[model samples]
Target: MEGFPTVELSGRKQHHCAPLCLLHFGPEGKMMPIAIQVQKCKLRCSAELTELLLRRLSQTPGPDCPIFLPSDSEWDWLLAKTWVRYAEFYSHEAIAHLLETHLIAEAFCLAMLRNLPMCHPLYKLLIPHTRYTVQINSIGRAVLLNEGGLSAKGMSLGVEGFAGVMVRALSELTYDSLYLPNDFVDRGVQDLPGYYYRDDSLAVWNALERYVTEMITYYYPCDAAVEGDPELQSWVQEIFKECLLGRESSGFPTCLRTVPELIRYVTIVIYTCSAKHAAVNTGQMEFTAWMPNFPASMRNPPMQAKGLTTLETFMDTLPDVKTTCITLLVLWTLSREPDDRRPLGHFPDIHFVEEAPRRSIEAFRQRLNQISHAIRQRNKCLPIPYYYLDPVLIENSISI
Candidate 1:
């Protein structure tokens, strides 16, 4: 079976390879002409090594030929070959492509492993110069959060450095962003086909908000030792100060706003939900009466989005808020654990899903219709008062 090409690849060999083509060695010492032409001829006898080599070669600069891989054979390898060979293809670009074109659950499993770093050759080819849209997995998000609390000596410093880089990248990316369809495909998902479908202005903003919330919950270090360390504290303070000061600056690129907004949102969410997420950052976290062990049925936290909640309540007041709210909900819904998720499972949809706890779908629809009625009026966008959120904050804090 062969892999196919969707977009043009770099170098002169582009034509020789189809976007979808399979490259496998045939019987004897000779190379088989799969979807891609074999040039290196460094065939490995081990099937595991052969697949790895083939996948890597396919990503290499190819000729001008349109490469085509028969879709039927992507998962056709013998069961015996699955174990040894699967791990080696961890960095295979085709895996992401396969996920976009086929099974989402499988793509999700691969994404959860975090085996492929953003620096992988395929990543460079696919997401070049794009840092605003990060590829996150549960493990990757966990590592960033360090939910285990056992931070070793060198790990904290590495995390801090990475966070610094991310912060700068976020503040530089544009707000009125355009996403190529291939970017979604690279992330192992696809958007609905339409001009408005790929437009992510709302998703970008929601992602920034959610990211900020995550940072507040997970990334901020709170140990006295960490806070006491002048160097580390200085870094945190400097970054935070920069974010606050530059937050509304017109000079800041919309592209980069997502990053800072995410950092800020994370800060607020952590402050609201569990101070522990911000424990390592502020060193002021105290275990309060609100902390308690939640049941397994509720072990996974339900979706929480302030923007979406606000948007829903004031829908009649603002038309743009409808689009923004739905987009926010879509972005928020994607990050929920699969077991706890509703519709808008992985991407955007025309209709919004109700995320409130204990609400029936019909009831949710009625409520949404009421809000839509208000939005249709000439009402203007109004800010959601902060006082009303205290109970929600307390509830979330206790659950954590």
Candidate 2:
């Protein structure tokens, strides 16, 4: 309100107005709102002044930008969060600057931008940076511990986009660190249920699944290869049994309810088994050798076996959906660039005709024949461009 001072201009011919602070003079020098305000320019200062007031109203603090914990007190604090977030939302240069300058605000902005849709280009940008940091043992440990204060940041990255990163991070930590503490185990397993509820969370799960699935398919031999490690083989079989049994039972939940998890499970199962079969059926070791190139790993033998079974079981549950999705994926994956990007042109435009009380089957059949004859006739006789047909002529000719 102090900044929102009003000014008064009387019956005077003037080009410019006085400073706002001067106009609010009152009795005994106390300030008061001016009865009338004059605009220096014909353009409305009212809108401009209103916007300025709004900006002041929306001012927020800089710290605690990423995590919007409810207890944030100052307006400036929330504002800082939005500012940092939008900056990161807009430009990579802003991210680089923030990282280089240790601008927590910029980092906060970057993390906040992850809340955008998984398909958004911004997700792709931020995901790679996380992967780069996760590869290092020290940074990854910090990430796992949440000491880096990136829980929201981690959650923001899309799952599929971050598949490789997830694999590397989870694998490295699993292998190099002490056994997951009871707390970590408890938190992780509990968090997964919630994670699997959201569609975006499925992306992360899918990536992890892909790695696990591929690993099992490559290593697990189809022809009694379980002889080398009978224990490992037994675990795999058990996992597969449990997964399949759960799916077959009435206890299994609807896919829509646990969509994210189901999607992840499906990807892992399908890809892993498919990869395995590809190797075995082709008599090629390509899939097995290519394992290290993927974004994740299998830390424990039991977990790996279970992951495979889980994937396979999940895949079994969504046969039709899986087939359709895979066909689309394959078409998209195999499509030629530029040409493939063009939409299909072969589809016919359909028009639904409403039934009339007086209409007969014979009349409908006759109309159909007429249309068919017209189409053939036009194809044979009219070699002109499609656009050459006059609208009036078409309307007259097509009239029933």
Candidate 3:
């Protein structure tokens, strides 16, 4: 804590000092700075002022080094030197703007990159240039919304930008590029680590697909202004029908042909189940009620209301017929897996309570399995094709 750096900025009538605080332990046990405490400022501190102060402070020998207040002659020279440096560097509009933008972009990209899982190769391959593109794409919706954009319009632009960046990122993934340290590939398939078998890139694509689909379904139906306009409504409907639901649409290239398409579809099932977890958190008990809600006598409900609970109200609120069909098909595909090999771990931040009653937990999993099987049988008569998974490797990639 004492080793941390502090900086003091001086001006005509005031001075401000900020000490960087170590807030959290990062991976590999490195200390990460969480905040800077700035004191006694009349005006808001700009990044330029903070950066200038830091640059000046770093000239000191070490964090333990102390600065003595200047004598009369020394004070005059210091003031003059500071003024000259500010005039030469900070006064230029073009240079200042470029530096500010670069700093903002770089900061955002680095923050995101740091959050990525260390197990994936994509985390290592994520160069600053590519991350900058991802940052732009991630914020494209907010930019559009700032420019008098509608929800549907903003979402469409966001999806388009996200898809473009994703395509470029995915294109970088190859057997050679991913399997680093030639020895990693030389190991037998059985000896290769679980992460190596996991295709993080594909997982990222699956998440992106689910997110985009959910957004489209959520906004396209609710935006009355867009839905009311004939032209806008037509365009929105066309995108929903042709681009998302129709597999034949060339307008929005899914890149499914090049990658394993099974997980892309399977993510819908994962999303549906994951959505229920959110519903539970928000006290939306229409789908499934948390165990805390049940009485002691009825802690174990009937088979119909066992671990998984389904309400007609929630089911009816789902997207249109085509979307629902695809979701069910994905759920069915997932149910076909053996009990132990189910993809429950693929979900984001999901954890089962170890202290929970074993009987109740097993009941819940059984209910989930039953629901998936029932949906599969219900859709068995339809011409819903299955994507084989044995040869298809699953990726564990993430998208912002």
Candidate 4:
């Protein structure tokens, strides 16, 4: 917004936002958004803009912030819903899909390759998750986050604001958030109805935990073995220093102290790379196919005053043709799975050869199949089926 052509629409409303949305479950166990507050960022509220319309120019979003209701005029309701979609697009693509799954998995891939040997047990456990991660992330840096990339030219936030969101989210991120079960429990969404994400993810996490505990116990045997491993210590330290930036407040452990600690950390890495990435990645196209639902950019800023909105003005705020095409093209590229994709729990590679680890892997695969079967049965009765985490559909790593 710093360099936006604010002069072009000086006579009209002078505001920019993507609006925050609050949602709850509907009676039939479906999602229902009740209120959506207009999102405000740093703005240059000029004297030329309306005095009462300063409500739009306000930098702070508060309890009194403007929102839309069902009774709002047709155009106003559309605007509010569009803004809420913008919020989803920004938070979903940038934070959940990109930052959390892709970048974080890249960190684990780098640390393990640098600090651990190919034959090491930890390497055998983690290397499969690193497949195609480097290639995809390299493409992301070159085309997405680079100067004048898709985000800069097409998205409303542009390069600076997108990067700002990334920085702020990273600063606030904690190790607790990465661990599956703890994250749901901490967010108090464990009991939320129609939450297939929580249920499927926790099941995957528990299965991965069982597999990890078995593998680690076979290799290390005791807590003392875990503490005495030099390569393991180095890998953890590298991730703490380089990936987490050594922030003690981040709650990322700098070293492995016990068998349980090692098992939990490794389980987190596996779950994040495989099932978590799939849960967010697979549904991207489904949500973004209709451009208005998750708009790449809104052409006009929001106005506070009622009756100012018209059908023509509403259409004007939508993304132009070029912007929409480029955005949809990029999402399609990122969302689609490749022909050579390996589904979760299906490791065709011969990375782990030892009988004990091989047996654990087989058991893990069986558990994932059971989870998939259960999800299929559950979805038959659900109003909307959730197949995002089905083992047969989920990729083993973030390939796209």
Candidate 5:
């Protein structure tokens, strides 16, 4: 064996370091540790520099032995696949973390109900937390229904906090029911046994509506105020219209039509913002970033400024964030597909059955652009702050 460049390792003991060396052996020969350079508490070795050293190793000539390195495109493809797996894993971890932390969980639920944007300085701090929250909320709604398993005893999150969790969890269930893959529906029901399975999108939509109705009835019993409140009634109707009965459009996914769904999708994001606030107030979380100088256009406006009177204010700003999130994910998945398209079932006025994957992606992007642009225009009229539509946030989110 010849001399190889060494890399320093920190905060690891010799017993733990032995296995790492064993794991990095090249096909040419076993990696032999020639020297151990110790400085202070750090242990350094040359055996672990596999990527740099392996390429320099002499190849053994044989018909069975082949030497090849992945091309840049191949490396990218591998990385993209890894990124998807990481995202999924991160989502699972986030849900588990929330289940363990009652305060964070409560804050998350509260954020969902309030749906208010935090100031830019605080918003940036919460972005990563919100990302994890959104992913977990989207994928872990079913897991939340296991009350016996996830119950946090001796923790006081208040009645409102509990309600927020229940509502957001139900909202996630609604989203999942509407957008689950056909194979997932089939296999999931079969594996569970005796669970009701929806065979088509329409069936799924109906089931979601029923679930939402039942949840509202059970969680928020029919009181005179609730029943008579026009805003609440209209909000419910809008949720149904956008989530279950919205018309198909070229830019937006047929399943995600309105701002309400977007609001639901980003429930975790809202929770993160609220959670950070709670943490900061209670001395649990701190920010190292300097105070942000928000743009003049983004500065708080006078209360007298005209804005959307109804929930349309929420809807208008929401779609911009929602469209951006959906489009980025759609494009990412599409780019990773073997044919640059994934079959997402048929929609009204669209012949998806015979459409090329490339064409479908193009149409989806076009629809996403249109929705984003429309929301931006609508946001201009609103006096309220719009953190979700922040250009920096959008750019950072898409990259993630």
Candidate 6:
């Protein structure tokens, strides 16, 4: 019930509180949450809150822990769940969505511009995916992450705390998990049932790998060829030194050696710029429309008493009308497709003119089209459709 090592999150100074939710399989084998453990630390009524929380459904989590479950007041349980989701919203918006995809892509795009020639195999293969990323990221820094920006207005973690999240995530992050397949294995979610994101990501990653292999092999036929290319080496080293801060702990390569290595690295960047961004960024509007489902901020502190919650209390905890409007407007604007969008593999800039690479592009487009068709057919049968990673819907860059 009591949090420690207090830090600011909700504008006012307080311990960083986040609920631990426990889930399990239901009667029909459906996965549903069983309990939510709430903590109140460094607040005015800590002892009273703990006393009220002592009477709970489960005690294994620890003494004096406020538990929200099915047996509790329905409004109390729902509000608890919403508060938990609010924490996830900050994590998703700050670290997973903005920092992981957009900011990192901008770094890659800058490295490419500075090191690779216009005709370099990697430059041509990747330039299309970096299109408009610079402009979008610049605007995001100004309007979305500025001191009193949308993040401060709508998020529980004001803009300052939001920036802190990004800094911490960047410091602790490594390159190993960015590789999609390794990420699946590392997280032990490779065989997690009905995880459409994992299933579709692997399919798309394999298809992407094939295309990158074709491009890299057409140019650098052997390991010696990869090691000999100065532009390629410079590009990777700059990314390691400048973007990754020359951290040996990061495991980013200073210089690529083999053709397969180059192919795999290129595939990782393209996947992040295209598919990963689409998965995390595109579904904001539909998921957050029902404010309570994905609340951006909480107006009141979390409930301390077990039987004190009511419908009015739950409604009062939600963000004010102004914050709600701003958050929804931003989500709607971002979810809409840009006018000059290029779907994944739909390159129109003609950066690569060689016959072999042109044919590879054609093949890549056909593969993505096939993936789109399969996803559409599968979505037709789903009770709640999730098609964010459909290659046809994914832009070639983090343009929005």
TM-scores across all candidates?
0.20, 0.17, 0.17, 0.89, 0.18, 0.89
Candidates 1 and 3 compared: the better one by lDDT is 3
Off by over 4 Å in 3: 1-23, 26-33, 36-259, 272-400
Q: Write the per-residue lDDT of candidate 2 for residues 1-400, one digit (tens) a residue.
A: 1121111112111111111111234355433333221112222366775575456443222332122222433332222222222222212211221111112212222332434344432232123222212222244234422422222122112222123233322222211111112323544443432221122223223333443333333434243442344333333243333322323332222221222333333333232222211111221122222222111111111111111334343222221332233323322322212221211111022121323311322342344344434444554654432211111111100000
Task: Give Cα distance to truth, residue 328, candidate 4, Å.
Answer: 0.1
Off by over 4 Å in 2: 1-75, 83-400
Q: Give the per-residue lDDT digits (tens) of candidate 3, residues 19-80.
A: 22224455655443332221212222456544654465432223332222222244332322
lDDT (tens digit, per residue) of candidate 1 on 222-317: 434333334333333333334323354423222212334434422322222222111111111121111111000001111112112232332221
* lDDT pick, better of 4 and 5: 4
Model 3 / residue 122 / CA error / Å: 31
Compared to the true structure, candidate 6 yields what TM-score?
0.89
Ordered by lDDT, highest first, the candidates read 6, 4, 5, 3, 1, 2
Regions more than 4 Å wrong, model 5: 1-355, 387-400
lDDT per residue as tens, model 5, 1-400:
1121111112111110000011223455443332111111112254543443456534232332222112223332222222222222222222322332232434333343333234222132223333333443433343332332121110112122334333333333333432334335554443332122222222323332332333233323445534454434443444344433332321222233333443333333332233222221221111111111100000111111112122433222111332233323322331221222111111122222323433543553344344345446656765652323211122211111
Give me the overall lDDT of model 2. Answer: 0.26
lDDT of 5: 0.28
lDDT of candidates 1 onward, in order: 0.26, 0.26, 0.28, 0.80, 0.28, 0.80
TM-score of 5: 0.18
Q: Which stretches of candidate 6 lie over 4 Å from their true place?
A: 1-16, 27-29, 41-64
